[model samples]
Target: MIHITRTLSIPDSEIQEQFIRASGPGGQNVNKVSSAVQLRFDVARSPSLPEAVRARLTVLAGRRINQEGILTIEAQRFRTQGRNRDDARVRLVELIRRATEVPELRRATKPTRASQRRRLESKQKHGDTKKQRRSVGPSDG
Candidate 1:
C-alpha cells in the first residue's frame, strides 16, 4: 500500500507496471534490458481516492491521463529497472499527495480608501507630466 496522506492509502492492485527497453544511460545493456518502467493507475475508478482528489488528479495528470482515466507515468531516469520502478511509484505518490491538498478560496476585496486615493494621485501626476510635455502653441503666454 502507498500512503499519500494521513487519510489516504492506495493499494498495490490499483497500480499496473510494465517493463520496456530503455534508450538511455546503460550503453550496450540499454538495448538488451527492459529497464524503463511504465506505470499506470486508474484514477477514475479508484476507491482509495475521494471524488475531489480524483477530479484534481485527472486535471493535474493532463496529457498523462487517457480518455479511459488511466494515468500513465514513464520512468527511465536510471539505468536499473528497480530504480525506475521505485521512481515511478514515488512520482505517483507525490502526485496523489499534491491532489489531496485543497487550494485556498479567494475572497473578493474592495480597494481600501488610502490605496484608491494613492492610485488616483499617481494617475493625476502622470497626466500632469504628459500635459507639460505638450508642444508650446503660439497662443501660450
Candidate 2:
C-alpha cells in the first residue's frame, strides 16, 4: 500500500506498471534493457479515491489522462528499473497529494475608496498627457 497521507492509502493493485525500452543515459544498457516504468492509474475507476478527489485528479493530470480515463506516467530518468519504478511511485503520490488539496475560495471584495481614487487619478493623468500631445488649435491663445 502507498500512503499518500494519514487518511489516504492506495493499494498496489490500483497501480499497473510496464517495462519498456528507454533512451537516456544508459549507454549500451539502453539498447539491451527495458528500464522505463510506465505507470497507469485509472482515475475514473479507482476505488481508493473519493468522487471529488477523482475529479480533481483527472483535471490536474490534463494530457497525462487519456480519453479512456487512464493516467499514464512514464519515469525513465534513472537507468535502472528499480529507480525508475520508485520515481514513478513518488510522482504518483505527489500528484495525488496535490489533488487532495482544496483550493481556497476567492473572497469577493469591493474596491477600496483610496484604490478607486488612485485608479481614477492615473486615468486622468494619462488622459491629460494624451490631450497635451494633440495638435493645438490656431484659435487657442
Candidate 3:
C-alpha cells in the first residue's frame, strides 16, 4: 500500500509497471538491458481516490493522462530498473499527495474607495502632464 496521507492510501495492485530500454549513460548495457520504468495508474477507475482528489489528479496529470484516464509517468533518470521504478513510485505518491490537498477558495474583492480615488487621481495627473506636453495652437488668443 502507498500512503499519500494519514487518511489516503492506495493499494500496490493499483500501479502497473512496464520496463523498456533507456537511451543514455549505460553504453553497451543500455542496448541490452531495459532500465526505464513506465508507471501507469488509472485515475478514473481507481476506488482508492476520493472524487475531489480524482478530479484534481486528472487536472494535474495534464498531458500525462490519456482519454482512457490512465496517468503515465516515465522514469529514466536512473540507469538501473530498481532506481527508476522507485523514482516513478515516488513521483506518483507526490502527485497524489498534492491532489489530496484542498485548494483555498478565492474570495472576490472590490478595490477600496481610497485606492480607487488614488488611481483616478494618478490617471488625471498623467493626463494633465501629457496635455502640458502638447504645443499651444495659434488660436490661443
Candidate 4:
C-alpha cells in the first residue's frame, strides 16, 4: 500500500506501470533498453481517494490527466528502469499529497476608510498637479 497521508492510503492494485524506451541521446543502450516508466492512476474510479481530493487531483493533474481520468506521469530522468520506476512512483505520491491539502478560504474584505480617503486624496492631488501643468489660454480672460 502507498500511504499519502495518515488518513489516506492506496493499494498497489490502483496503480499501473508500463515501461517504454527512453527517448533522446544515450547511444546503443538507450535504443535497446526500455528505461522510462509511465505510471498511471485512475482518478475518477479510485476508491482510495475522497471526493474532494479526487476533484482537486483532477485539477492539479491538468494535462497529465486524460479524458479517461487517468493521470500519467513519465519518468525518464534516470537511465536505469528501476530508478525511473521509483521516480515515477515518487512523483505520483507527491501529486496526491498535494491534492490532499485543502486550500484556505479567502474572506472578502473592503478597503479601510482611512485607506479609501488616502486614495481619493492622492488622486485629487495628482489631478491638481496635471491641472497646474496646463498652459493658460488667451480665451481664459
Q: Which candidate tops TM-score? A: 1
> What does the lDDT read for residue 61 in candidate 4?
95
Worst 10 residues of 3 by lDDT: 22-31
- Candidate 4 accuracy as lDDT: 0.96
RMSD of each: 1.9, 2.1, 2.1, 2.1
Q: What tens digits encode model 3's per-residue C-alpha lDDT throughout 18-55?
A: 99999768789899999999999999999999999999
After superposing candidate 4 on the true structure, give the runs of residues whose Cα lies further than 4 Å from its correct spot: 128-141
Candidate 2 lDDT tens digits, 1-141: 999989999999999999999986778999999999999998888999998889999999999999999999999999899999999999999999999999999999999999999999999999999999999789985
Which one wins on lDDT? 4
Query: In model 3, which runs have C-alpha deviations exceeding 4 angstroms?
Result: 130-141
Residue lDDT tens for model 1, 101-125: 9999999999999999999999999
Query: What TM-score number comes out for model 2?
Result: 0.87
Q: Better model by lDDT, 1 or 2?
A: 2
Candidate 1 worst ten-residue window by lDDT: 22-31
TM-score, candidate 3, is 0.88
Report the CA-based lDDT of candidate 1 relative to the real structure. 0.94
Q: What is the TM-score of each candidate against the true structure?
A: 0.89, 0.87, 0.88, 0.87
Q: Put down candidate 4 lDDT per residue, 1-141, tens digits, no spaces.
A: 999999999999999999999998788989899999999999999999999999999999999999999999999999899999999999999999999999999999999999999999999999999999999999987
Better candidate by lDDT, 1 or 3? 3
